[model samples]
Target: MQQGSVDAFGAPVSADTLKRYSGGAITVNSTQAITGTVSNDSASQVVTGNNAITGDAFSSASGLPSVIQNSGNNVLIQNGVIVNVEMKP
Candidate 1:
C-alpha cells in the first residue's frame, strides 16, 4: 500500500474508512458505527454509539479531536500525521 493510493478494493491505502467533511472544516460529527479506520479533514465525525473506535492516519491534529478511543489496535501516524491504520475489536 502507498500513501494516497487506493487498493484493489478502491479504498485508500491510508484509510480503512473515511467519512468526508461536508462543511469545509474538520469536526467529530459522524453518527455511524466504525469498525475500521476513519480519517477526514474538514469533516466532522460524531460518534452516536458506545464503541471504542479506531482512527486512520489522521493528519493536522490541529483540526482533530483531543482524545480518540479505539478497541484493540495501536494507531499509526505518518508525516507527523496519521495515515494508515486498522480497526478495534
Candidate 2:
C-alpha cells in the first residue's frame, strides 16, 4: 500500500516461477492440474495452461500485446497466462 495502508488484495505478491507459482507460488505437485499466466510486459503476455499437470508440460503464452503501451518492459500475469507484455525501448 503506497498510501500508507495495508490491504490483502492491494498488497504485492512475490512470485519466482510462472507455472509453479501462478497462485502466489504454491508448491504443487506435477499432477495437480496446474495453470498460470505470466506477463512479459505491459503490451504483451505469456498465457500458459496445464490442466492435467500429470507429469507433463503445458502450453506457455507468448506475445500477448493488445495495445502499444509502456515505455519499458512490464510484466503481468493473470489466470496462469500472460495477459499483456511490452518490450523495453
Candidate 3:
C-alpha cells in the first residue's frame, strides 16, 4: 500500500478509521494509511491498492450537498448493508 488521503464529506478522516480501512484481506496487509484530505481545488486523485469504504452517517454542511465518485474500479457494499447516501444537494 501507499500513502494517501481519505476524506469524509470533504473533512479529514480520522487516523483510527484509516487503520481499519487499510487492514488486511487475507495474506498481505497495507503498511501505511495516512489520514488527511486533498485541497478543494484538486482536479483529480488516484487511489492504488486495497481500499475500503465504511458506513457513516451523512450530514449537510453549509446547506450544500456531498458527492462521492469512483471510476474504473469496483465499489463493494459488503456485510449485507446498504446505506442510502445521496450524492446531490
Give the winner by lDDT: 3
Error of 3 at 10 (Å): 0.1
- Write down the TM-score for model 2: 0.14
Q: Provide the overall lDDT of each model, using Cα atoms, as 2-decimal numbers.
A: 0.43, 0.41, 0.44
Clashes of 3: 0
Better of 2 and 3 by TM-score: 3
Question: What is the C-alpha lDDT profile of model 3 across 1-89, one tens digit per residue?
Answer: 22453454455556677767663444533354444544444334656454454455343245444454444333432232233333221
The predicted structure with the larger TM-score, 1 or 2, is 2
> Per-residue lDDT for 35-80 in model 2, tens only?
5556543545745443333333324535552322233334343233
In model 1, which regions exceed 4 Å deviation?
1-48, 68-89
Model 2 vs truth, CA RMSD? 21.0
Number of clashes in every candidate structure? 13, 20, 0
Residue 50 error, candidate 2, Å: 15
Worst 10-residue lDDT window, candidate 1: 13-22
- lDDT of candidate 1 vs native? 0.43
Candidate 3 lDDT score at position 25: 44
TM-score of 1: 0.13
* TM-score list, all predictions: 0.13, 0.14, 0.18
